[model samples]
Target: MTTTQKYAATGAWNEPEGATPRGTVALLPGRGETAASYARLGRRLAADGYRVRYVPVTLDDIADARAAVEELLADESLPAPRVLLGSDSGAALAGQFVAELPVDGAVLAAIALPGSAHGEVGADWADEVDARTACPVHRAVLATDEEFARGAIASPLPWETIAIGAQDRPTLALHGTDDRVTPLAPALEVYARAARTDVRLVQGGRHDVLNDVAHRSVAATIVLFLESLRLSPEAPPIVTGLG
Candidate 1:
C-alpha cells in the first residue's frame, strides 16, 4: 500500500513483492472523487502485478488535471504498456487521453454520456449511495468519505466535450445494465464509434461499476485484457475453448 503525491491527492500501488510488473495504469477518478475512492481498485490491480496510479482530475481546472496525467504517464518508473483507466466522468477523460496521449490502451467504466440525466442530484444520502453502488463496503466508503461530493452522481457532466471518442488504441468499455445515472443505450452508441472497443456489461450494476458488487470479476476481466495486450497491442484473447 505504498503511495506518492505531487499535483493532487494521488495514490499509487506497486506490484507484489516478487512478481514481474505487468503494466501501468494511470487511473482518473470520477467527478467529486478523491484518490481514496479507488483504494480497493488500486490494491487489487497491484496485487495482480500491474502498477496502479490513481490520479485525481479536477473539472475546475482541466489544464491542471491533464498536466498531472501527462506527468504521471511520462514517469519512466511506471513501466510501459501504459493504460488509462477511468470511471464516470473520469472515464470520459480516459477517452480523451487515449485519443490524445501515447497510452497503449484504456478502460472506460460507467461512462457519463452527453445529455444523459446525470444532472439531478439524488434526494438523500441513502438514495445517493444506492444509485452509486450496491457493494456494502463501497457504500460505507462513500458514507464516511467526507471529501466525496455526496450528490455528484446526479450532477451533469460536460459530456459533449468529454464523452469518449473514436481511438486507435485497444479499449475496453464497461457499463452496468442497471446504471441509473447514464443508461446503457446511449453509452453503446458512444462506444460504437470506436471499432476496436471491447465492451462488457455488469448485471444489476449501478453507476460505479468499478466498485460494485461484481468488482472481482470486473478486475479479472481487466487483467485478462492486460494479458492480451502483453501478447500484442491488438489484445488477442490468450485462452480459448477447451480442446
Candidate 2:
C-alpha cells in the first residue's frame, strides 16, 4: 500500500493497512535529511504491520517535528505500542524525549556515535557520501536530498538528562561498522551507559543502515526488537545475533 501522505511542511504521516497494526512508528530523519530520505525505511515498516509516520526534521524544524509526533500519538486509528526511530543526528533528537514521552520504545540508528563533537566533515566525506546507501540507485535518490541537505546538526550529550528512571524503557542503538559519519565506538559508549540497551553493528554497513545493502537484515532485527517491546516485561530477550 502507498504509505506516503501529505502533512505540514513536507508531510509526516502514518500508513496502516489490513488488520490492526502491530504498532505505530515515528521516524525522524537526520540533518541534511528530509522525509523523502525515509521512503524505503517507512515502506519496510509498514509492510511489517506497522503504522509508520515520518516526523519531518531539519535544523530549525525540531519544534514542528515534536508536534508531529504528538499528533500521531493522539491518532485514534493507531495502536497502543509506539516506537520512535531516528537516524544520525536525528537520533539525538529522538533520544531527548525518552522520559515523559508516551512512546514505548526507541531506536537510534547510525547516531552520531558518542564522541567529541566536531563541525567539519572528514576529508573523505564527499567520496563516501553515496556509500551510505548500499544500493547505488537508492544512493542516487538520496543525493537529491543531500545536495539540498541542511548543514551539520549538533549532537549534545543525549544521556545526560535521560530522566533518572527512564532507563527502564527498551532502547536499541544500531550502527554500521564502517560508518564514517558516525563512528561505531561512540554509539557503543551510548549503549554501555543505558539500562536495557541492545546494540547491533552491521558488518561493512555504512551510515544508512535503514537503506543500506543489508537494510533487510537491519529492518528484520528492528521488527524483532519492537516485537519484544510489545511483549510482557518478563518475556525472554530478543536474540538478534546481529553483532
Candidate 3:
C-alpha cells in the first residue's frame, strides 16, 4: 500500500489505493513537536491501512487541542475502532481524553509524569537530543525541524489537569527502559491504575520510544495492539503459545 499525505499543518496520512482503512489513529504530539515530527510514524501506520492524523497539541492552547481532537474523532470519514495515541506530554493529554471521550482504545508512549526526575533542565541542544533519542535520523529531525521545541523535554507537565483514571477501554502503554526524561518506575505506576492495560518496554531506548532506534519494532508492536483491538477492546493476543 502506498502512503499519501494530506492537509497542510495538521498532517493526515491515508490508506493506500483500493485498500479499506482498518482503523483511525488521532495522535496528539508531545511538547514542542509539530506535525512534521511524526511523519515517519504517520507513514508507517498508513502503510498498514490505519489512517493516522497528527493532531497538534501544546501546553499553550490545550482547549483548542481538545476541540480539535473531538472534531477529528467525530469525523465519519475516519474508520471505526478509533484510537487516541500520544507520546510524552502528549500521552498525558491522550489519557485525559480517554477518560472523557468515546474513543475505542488508546496508545500511550513515553509518558512524562509529574514529580519524575528528568535530567538537567536548560541543557544544551545536543544533550536534549541525546536524551530524547539515539537515532541519527531522529536527532537530525530534531536538529533541523524549525517547528520542534528544543528544550521542551524538561518543561513541566500539568499533572493536576492530566490525571489518568482507570480506563474501561483497552490501553497500550509503551516506555523505554533507559529513558532519561520520564523514568520507567513512575510511568509503570500510572499504567498500573488500569488493570487491563498492556505494557511494552523498549530496552536501551531513550525518551522518544516511537522514534528510537528500535522504531520498526515499536511500530510493529503498535500494529499488533491495533489489530488486537479490532477484534475486541480487551486486545486478545493474536499470537499465542509462547511460554
Candidate 4:
C-alpha cells in the first residue's frame, strides 16, 4: 500500500519507496489494452524493487514508444539494464522495437504471433471475455476500459518486426496453453525464430496471462528473468529506423 503512484491522462507509473530499483520496465499495453489494466501488475512489480512505466498504445504508438523507451534508458534516476514488457499484441510491437532499440531485454506475454487465429466470440462475447482472463476482477476492469471495449485489432503489424529478427540479448516469450486469441503453436514458432528466446507456456492460462488470476506468478517469473540481466553491463546503442 506504500507504493508511490504517478499518473498521466493516458498512462500511469508505479515505484516502490525505500528500495532501490534495479531497472526500468517500459511496459506497452496491447491493442485494446489500457494502462489501468496493468495497475495491479505494475504495483506487484514495483513491490519487487523495479520501476514500471505503463504506456497506453495508440495507432502510431511504436514511434512514440521508441521515444519513451529511449527516455527511460536515458533517465539517470532509474537503474539499468532497461527492458521492454509487452502483452498480447504489444508483444508484436516489443519484438519489433527490440531489434531497433538497444535495450537489455524484453518480456512478451500472451503474444499474438504470426500464423495465429482469433478466438471465436458469439452471442456470449461476455463469457468469451471472461474466459480470456482468469481474474474475475480484471474481467470487470477489462469490460469497463473504453479501449478494451472498443476491441481494436493489432496495430502497426508484426510482419516487418518479425522480419528484422530478435535482438542479441535475452528475450522471454510467454503464452498460455489454451490461448485461442493467438494460440500456443504459433507462439512457439515465432519464439523459435528468435535468436535467444526463453519461452514459457502456462497450462490452463488464457490470452491475458499478465493480468489473469495467476498474474502474481507471471509477474514473479518476469522479475526473475529481469534479475538475470540486472547486472549485465550496458551495450551499444541500436539504430532506430525501419530495417
Candidate 1 ranges with C-alpha deviation above 4 Å: 1-10, 116-121, 159-163
Worst 10 residues of 1 by lDDT: 1-10
Instruction: Count the clashes in each prediction.
Output: 1, 1, 0, 0
Q: Write the per-residue lDDT of candidate 1 for residues 1-243, one digit (tens) a residue.
A: 235232124577889898999899999988767876788888888898999988878766767888989998888888878899999888888887787787899999988865644524467878777888899998877777788887676666643444455467899999999887878887888788787899999999888899999999999999998888888988898989987
What is the C-alpha local distance difference test score of each model? Answer: 0.82, 0.67, 0.83, 0.70
Model 2: per-residue Cα lDDT over 146-237, one tens digit each: 44353343333333322212377777878888776666765676667767767888998887778788888998988888788778433246
Off by over 4 Å in 4: 1-10, 114-124, 153-164, 233-243
> Each model's TM-score?
0.91, 0.79, 0.92, 0.82
| Error of model 2, residue 71, in angstroms | 2.8
lDDT ranking from best candidate downward = 3, 1, 4, 2
lDDT of 4 by residue, 1-243 (tens): 333223323354545566777778889777667676887877778778888887555545457867766766676776677788988777877777777776778888877654334454343556557547878888877776665644453322434334314648788888888776776776777788887788887778888889777777788888878777864533322334575
Candidate with the greatest TM-score versus the true structure? 3
Model 3: how far is 56 from its true place, Å?
0.8
- Deviating ranges (above 4 Å) for candidate 3: 1-10, 116-122
lDDT at position 80, candidate 1 = 75
lDDT of 3 by residue, 1-243 (tens): 133223325588888889999999999888778777788888899899999988877676778778889988889988988999999988988877886777888899998786544444446887888888999988877887787878888888755434564368888889999988888887888888876678999999888899999999999999999999899877889988958
**Candidate 1 RMSD computed on C-alpha atoms after optimal superposition onto the true structure:** 2.9
- Against the true structure, candidate 3 reaches a TM-score of 0.92
Quote the lDDT for 132 in model 1: 82
Top model number, lDDT:
3
